[model samples]
Target: MDERTVRKTISQLAYCYAVNRRVSDPVQFSIAGLTGKAEKIFNSYPSYSNWDVNVSNKNLDELWNPKQIVYLTADSNNLLETLNEDKVYIIGGLLDHNHHKVFEILVNFCQSLDWKKAFLNVIPKRKGIGEEILSEYKKGEEITTVLIMLSLSGASNQPPGTAFIWISSILAIIVDCLLIMTIGLELEKSLFSYQSLLNWPLVECIFSSLFAINFFISIWLCFNGKSFSDDRTSYSLAATFSLANFVQYTLNVIYHVRTWIAEQKSAMQVIDPRGVGVTSYGGP
Candidate 1:
């Protein structure tokens, strides 16, 4: 997470807290592990303090009982049916990336590198952003490969609407590449005057939704144009990939939508009079 993400999170938290108050739900929102950008954001924004947000420069365990705090993660096998009104739940600070065992492993390994002695023949000391290792979830490779096959097969085999398939496939590649560039890139700030108005899931939702329609249209053309019905191996292969990508895009849309909604709900639902941390992480 960068300063922008952390700032956005605090802003969203404030928004949710206000919403909760409007509904007569008393909730205490706490932010722990305040350092670097986090501390700066907290201190600079008097509104946060005014909002009655609990701020701390410590870890969750240092401030709260371990058993009372539930740290939410995607890979947790223990499914929590519902939120316990008495318990405090912690959500990771980053918006797109979920912290799990794998993330811990990578972060630990990265942190260890800075401790190695240069002439000890151990791994050389280095400092780098570990979370960047598992940045964005992507299905572009499979999708792009499928699109290529579809376009090529249609063109070589001379299927009906071959031109349409080729043009659409090319456009699809452009969209996929655009999505890829957004990962670990500052295009939002550089390209848009209002960078705060943009976020990953929203951008992803738009792309996936548009591509879902694209895939649907392509699939329809495939069936009626005999791209799928053709007896030739080329057309069948193209149709197969096209269908697969369509399903993938649809799933992408559903996944992003669910993620966005859950974020909103979780942000608004954490009600604690004493206060509890939402998450702790690096910010720029």
Candidate 2:
């Protein structure tokens, strides 16, 4: 059928599910059991007010009992199942354009069903948040850029400097070792005792070794492969430097949340000039 026809049919089905008294007729078949709790909730807040019901009821008399269910053919099985469980069979098609809202309602309705009783099969339409995906991607990109900037400007600057220092320390250690060996050889031929041959050289070697180890570890962490990805690597690298940049990001997020919470709290705490914090305060 044409899109308009399908939409119209779906509207009719929604109406039947929502407001049509015809759909209230209790069916005999029970495939899946419905829980008493679900029944109570359904009874409390009937689905007759749903927009789907209004739209559907406008077009057809028998909302759920259409001669042929045309719109949302794929979801027919699940819909039937749900209806049978509720002991209320729907004949009209389900509104598909505003499917996200419809799915939520369906979920709530299903939750109210009694699990003790099984009913006929019903199919539900799939919903998507395609529009939100692009927004999320943009948000991530903005955060990554901010992180990169903070890393370059703040104490996180040590990442690059630390790398250079690490290399220099290694070279210094090598040179000190060679000097110690040469000095020891020279003293062996002279009046100087072996212990005195390279007294200062030994001390220098010990200090150089310590600096070398520390610098090497820093470089290892700086170049670790974890932050090399095309998408988030830049931000991850910033996180690795000085640890302060990482802390900054965490604090920034916390600050935003706190600000929001404070605003909410302040709004809640607002009182009239009489010092009474009540909802009855006059207009601003």
Best by TM-score: 1
Worst 10 residues of 2 by lDDT: 114-123
* lDDT: worst 10-residue window of model 1: 114-123
TM-scores, one per candidate: 0.32, 0.21
Each model's C-alpha lDDT? 0.52, 0.41
Q: How much does each candidate deviate from the true structure in C-alpha RMSD?
A: 32.6, 29.0
Candidate 2 — number of clashing residue pairs?
38
How does model 1 fare in lDDT?
Answer: 0.52
Q: Candidate 1, clashing residue pairs?
A: 28-272
Error of 2 at 110 (Å): 40
**Cα lDDT of model 1 by residue, 1-284, tens digit:** 68889887666555545644543334456777878887788689766667666778899999889989988776887644334567877866654332222222222323333211111222222423332332221233334345444532332122344455557656776776676666524444423223455555445545654554555455444444433335365456546656656666677776567667766765666544345544333222
